[model samples]
Target: MEKKKRFGVLLCADDSEYVKKKYGGYFQVFVGLLGEEGETWDLFRVVNGELPNDEDIDAYDGFVVTGSCSDAHGDDVWILDLVRLLRRLDSMRKKVLGICFGHQILSRALGGKTGRASKGWDIGVTCIHPSPSNKLLSSLCIPSHLLIIECHRDEVWEPPPHAEVLARSDRTGVEMFRYGEHMMGIQGHPEYTKDILVNLIDRLLRHKHIQTSQAEAAKASLKEKEPDREAWKRLCRSFLKGKSLS
Candidate 1:
């Protein structure tokens, strides 16, 4: 019998009540998108200071870093620890994927710059154009413009040294990037559904993270277009699973 493929998720955010009740937390959400049959998925809540031990790092075939409510540039203790962990992953050349805050933190850990977006928060579906410079991306046959669900205040200003930028959008320059063959980062939420985004928007308004007008505008933008969920899933899965486009 073939050995089962193992994957780990470094969850950087605490689950919201709705997510916890409906999906059993963000881990399930990620697995729902990326998990394959006969594969084992594990979770480490980095938000609560949980991480895989160094000795056990090689046990998984790949790992994913989830989005967070905190800024990637902050000096929090857990953030610093997570940075160190990311650096170690890079040195190992293990397959890794990052989303939103995870994307920013990965850039920072790899010697890139990340900070608050100059244009303010981007909280709706936005179009991203993939770069043709990367051979893998070039062969994916993705459209000239791909729409994705984005909800981030921070953006990657510069990618790490030797990293190939895979995609970009009007609001954020580094929508996606790949470091070597084993690592990738994306600034949008492929795991999220429209309902999740709408709930998050309401929470942002309730907590004053965004104004009511801003929230309304974000909601209005969603009606214009939907995210290219299947394309993103295929691209991300191919990269993480080391599959090639035929």
Candidate 2:
């Protein structure tokens, strides 16, 4: 039997596993796995605090940046170092994907800025509307509305140069964008499931990151906002099979 293709996943944080669980664990984290070309994906955890440079960064087939529970503007050296790594990756035109914190990192690394969210923490699913129509949207499994999990307090004030705004949401216009398409970043968590959204909402409410009323409002909004699962699945597959020229 032919082996699965190998993609490298530069797992970025302690909470990565927790986030992975939200998306069905290791099986659906969407991080690239690297191995003998035809082997399975091997998620390589890279703690940015340790600081890795180009030599340290070049070994992966692809790279994935995860959301950090830590703040991007805070004095976390790792976050700064990650900016360096992402800048290098961007220069090389590598297939890099950043979600949430990852997205902020990419933007900041490329001469952009990140700050607090305009609406605070968005704890449930949201509807990301495609910026305009294209092949990527052509394969979507649902309507232009994409229902995915969100939990962030910061956002990109301005996207990097050469970036394309592929999708946006009413909650946050930077819902989804492409760093050249093949290299993409999304503000929402498409990898997560409905149950995961519920579980995360539970966790956030328990910790007071969100209030009971907010959770209730978010749930009701999501019910009416998100696209179908099949549509989301189509979006994922489209991302996986990125443009040949991106």
Q: How many residue pairs clash in each candidate?
A: 0, 10
With a 3 Å backbone cut-off (N, CA, C), the pairs that clash in candidate 1 are none
Shift of residue 207 alpha carbon in model 2, Å = 2.1
User: In model 1, where is the ten-residue run with the lowest total lDDT?
Assistant: 237-246
Q: Write the per-residue lDDT of candidate 2 for residues 1-246, one digit (tens) a residue.
A: 743444555556665346555554533455322122344455555554544445745544466666666666555666666777777777877777777877777777877667888878776667677754666665443466556778777887778788777777776767666766556777876555566567667777888888899889767766766635556555554564444423
Q: For residues 1-246, write the lDDT of model 1, one tens digit per residue.
A: 877889999999999998998889999999999998989999999999999999999988899999999999998999999999999998998888999999999999999999999899999888899986666666777788999988999999899999888888888889998888888899999999888899999999999999988898889878888889998888888889876422
CA lDDT of every candidate = 0.90, 0.64
Candidate with best TM-score: 1
Stretches of model 2 off by over 4 angstroms after superposition: 1-4, 15-28, 31-39, 48-59, 139-142, 221-230, 240-242
The TM-score obtained by model 1 is 0.96
RMSD after CA superposition, every candidate: 1.6, 4.0
lDDT of 1: 0.90
Question: Top lDDT: which candidate number?
Answer: 1
